[model samples]
Target: MKFLHLISIIISSIFLLNPAFGQTDQWPKRTIKFVVGFGPGGANDIVARIVAEGVSKQLGQPVIVENKPGAGSVLGADFVAKSPSDGYTFFVSAGGIITNPMIKKSMPYKEGDLVPVALLAVSPSIIVVPPDSTIKNLRDLIARAKDAKGIQFSTAGTGSTPHFVAEMLKVNAGGKYDIIPYKSGSEAKVAVLSNQVDATSESSAVTIPQIQGGKLRAIASTWNKRIEALPNVPTTKEEGYPQILIGHWAGLFAPKGTPNEILDKMNKAVEAALKSSEVQKRLVPQGIEPTPGSRASFVNFLNDERNRLAPIVQRANMRDD
Candidate 1:
C-alpha cells in the first residue's frame, strides 16, 4: 500500500511541476513596459500611447510607455533588446531599426537582437514648404533644386526614414539639394515653417497640423497612395520619382529568446488595440495607419523593408558616422 501511495504522490508531484500546468496561467500579473525609441509627441510615442491604452484594457494590466529617446531612437531599442525576455518588457520603435544598421558605423545591439512582435503603424513623410513659399508642386521643387545654387532641405535627423527619403530625392532627382539635419522631426518642421530651410520632408504626423493651419504647404507624399489628411498632395510616384517612396513605420519587438507564447499574446493584444475604434479615430488624422499584424508577418515585412532599402543605402553611400 505504501508503494502505491508513493507512486500516486510522485504522479501528483510530476503533474504539479509540469510547465503545462501553469504555462497559460497568471501571465501578465504585473505591469508591462512598452519602451519607445523617440521622445514624446513624435509618431512613435503617439502610436505607443494610443496602443498602450487599448493593450492595457485588453490585458487587464497597466501598459506604460517609457521614452528613452536619442541616437535616432537607438537608445530605446537597445534598452529593450537587452532587457529580460519576460513578456513584461516590449519595445515600440520606428524604421530606424533597419535603417540604422545600414548607415551607422556600429550599433550597441544587432538588428536580430529583438524579435518582431507587431507592426503598429505606417506614417508617410510629406514634402512641405512654408505657406508663402513659391514652390508649389513636386516638379517645380525638383526643377528649382537643380536650377538653384543652394536649394536646402531639412529632415528629422540623419538615418531617419525622412532623412533617407530626402537623400533619395537628391540622388534620384539628380539635384544638388543640400540636406540639413535636425535633432528631431519637430525641429526640422520648424526649420521649414520659419523658412530657416527651403524645404523638408517630415512625417505627416508632424506636418498635418501645420498644413491644416495653413502654416505649411504639402507638395508631395512618400506614400504610394495619397494621405487623407493631405488629400490634394501628390505622391512621389505621381511626381515621377517613385524611388523616393519611403516613409516612417512603427512596430513592437521583444528581446531575442522571448518565448513565442508571450510574443503571441502581446501580438494579439496589439491587434485588438489597433482594431479598436479609439485607436483609429485618434491616429488616422495624425497621418498614421495602424498595421496590427502577426509575428511572422512582421518579420516578413522587416525583411522586405531591408531588401527595399538596401539598394538605396548602397547607391547613396549613406552612413551615420
Candidate 2:
C-alpha cells in the first residue's frame, strides 16, 4: 500500500510539471475554426482559406475558414473576441482592427479583447486613376486638390485604411480632398473607373488586375517601398510624402484570456503555413507578402501601428459612429 501510494504521487508530479502531460497535448482534438471578418472570395477570405489549408495539414487536423462578414468586419471581430479561449477559434482580419476603436465612437470590443497570434501578410494600398483621367501623378492630384472644392477620392469606407491613406496624403501633400465612401474596395474602384471620383486607393492585390488590364493607371503606392507587383509605380516615399506610408495587413488573433501555450502552438502552425511553398506561391504574386513572426513580435507590431495611426485618426477627427 505504501509503494502504491508513492507511485501515484510520483505520477501526479510528472503530470503537473510536464506539458507533455495531457490537457494541452490533446488540444486540437477537433476542427480548428478561423473566423474571417470578410466575405468569401475576397482578399481576406482567400488568404484565410490558403493559410487554413496549410495549417490543417501541418497540425494534422481540419482547420476551417468561416466568414462572418458584416459592419466593416466588427461583427466577426466581436464574435471572436467573445469566443471560448480554448484555442479552437481565431480571428483573421486586416490591420483595421487596431485602428477601428480609435476611429469609431462605439466598438463592440476594446483593443485588449484579442491577443495577436501571428502576422499573416502585408499588402500595400495603391492609389489609382482611370486610364483616361487627366491626373497624371501624385503631384498632379495634389495640385488639383489645392483648388477650391479639392479633388474627389473614393475608398472602401469612411474609416478604413484606404480612407486613412487618402487623408494622410491630403495632410502631408498640403491639400484638401473630398472623400467618397463606398461599401467595398470594388465599388471604390468602379467609382474611379467610371470617372465618378478622381482617384481611389485599393490594395495592390485588388488593383493589380485593373492596372494590368489597362482599366486603371497606377499612380502611387502607400508604402515605404515600391510594390514588386507594380514595379513602375512609385511609393509614397518616392512621391515625397513618406509620412503617408500605409500598408494593410492580415493577422491571426484569439480572445484575450486564451492560454499562452495554445497561442504559441497557433503561431507555430501559422508560421509553418506561411513558409509552405503553396502559401508563398499564391501570396507573393498577388502583392501579399507573408510575414510570420512570434507572438511578442506581433504584439509589438500592433502597438507600433496603433500608435502611428492614432495621430492620423485624431488629426482628421475621423469617426465611424
Candidate 3:
C-alpha cells in the first residue's frame, strides 16, 4: 500500500511538471481550429491558411481556418481571447490587435487575452491616390491638400491602421483631411481608384498590381525604407514626413491559458511554416516581409506598441469603430 501511494504521488508530480508527459497520446486528437479575425481572400486569411497548410501536415491533424471578422476584428479577437487556451484555438491577428485596446476604454480583452505565439509577417502600407488625379506624387499630394478643401482618404474601417496612417499623415503635414472608412483594404482601394474617395493607404501586396496596372498610383511607402517590389517608390521618411510613420502587421497568437507544451509545439510549427520556402516565395515577392519574433519577444513588442499608441489614440480623440 505504501509503495503504491508513493508511486501515485510520483506520477502526479510528473504530470504536473511536464505537459508533454502524455501529449503524444492527447495532442491534436481532433481537428485544430485556426481563427482569423478578417474575412477570407484578405491577407490575414491568406497567411492563416498558408500556415495552417503546413502546420496540419506537421501536427498530423487538420488545422481549420475560421473567420470571425467584425468591430475592427475585435469580435474575432475577443472570441479567441476568451477561448480555451488548450492550443487548439489560435488567432491570426492584425494591427487592431494592439490599437483596439488603446482606443477602447472598456475593451473585453487586454494584451493578456491571447498569447503571442510568433510574428508571422509585416506588410507595410502604401500611400495611394486616385489614378486620374493630378497629384503626381507625395509632394504634389501634400501641396494640393495645402490649398484644397479637407482631403478625403479611405481606409479599412475606422480605428484601423490605415485610418491612423492617414491621420498621422494629415497631422504631420498640418493639412486637414477627412478619412472615409470602408469595410476592407480592397474596398478602400477601389474607392480611391474609382475616384469616389481621394486617397488611401494599403499594403503593397494588395495594391502593387493595381499600381502597376495603372489602376492606382502609389505615392509613398509607410516604412522607413522602400520595399523591393516597388523599387520606384520612396519612403515617407525620405519624403520629409518622418513623423507620419505607418506600418500594418500580422501575426499568430494562441488563446491565453493554452498548455505550454502544446503552445511550444504550435509555435515551432508556425516558425517552420514562416521559414519554409513556399511561404517566403508567396509573401516576399508581394513585399510582405516576415517579422519572426519569439513568443516572449512578441509579447514584449505588443506591450511596447500599446504604450506608444495610447497617447496618439487619445490625442486624436478617435472613437470610430
Worst 10 residues of 1 by lDDT: 17-26
The TM-score, computed over Cα atoms with residue i paired to residue i, of candidate 3 is 0.89
Q: Which ten residues in a row have the lowest lDDT in candidate 2?
A: 15-24
**Against the true structure, candidate 2 has what lDDT?**
0.86
lDDT of 3 by residue, 190-257 (tens): 88988998888988778888888988889899887788888999998998887777677787887766
Per-residue lDDT of model 2, residues 154-194, tens digit only:
98886787798888987888787888899988888899999
Q: What is the C-alpha lDDT profile of model 1 across 59-138, one tens digit per residue?
A: 99999999998888889999999997778888898888988889899999988899999999988989898899889988
Task: Estimate candidate 1's alpha-carbon lDDT, on a 0 to 1 scale.
Answer: 0.86
RMSD of each: 3.4, 3.5, 2.9
User: What local distance difference test score does each model get?
Assistant: 0.86, 0.86, 0.80
Per-residue lDDT of 297 in model 3 = 79
**How many pairs collide in each candidate, listed in order?**
0, 0, 1
Query: What stretches of model 1 exceed 4 Å from their correct place?
Result: 1-24
RMSD of 1: 3.4
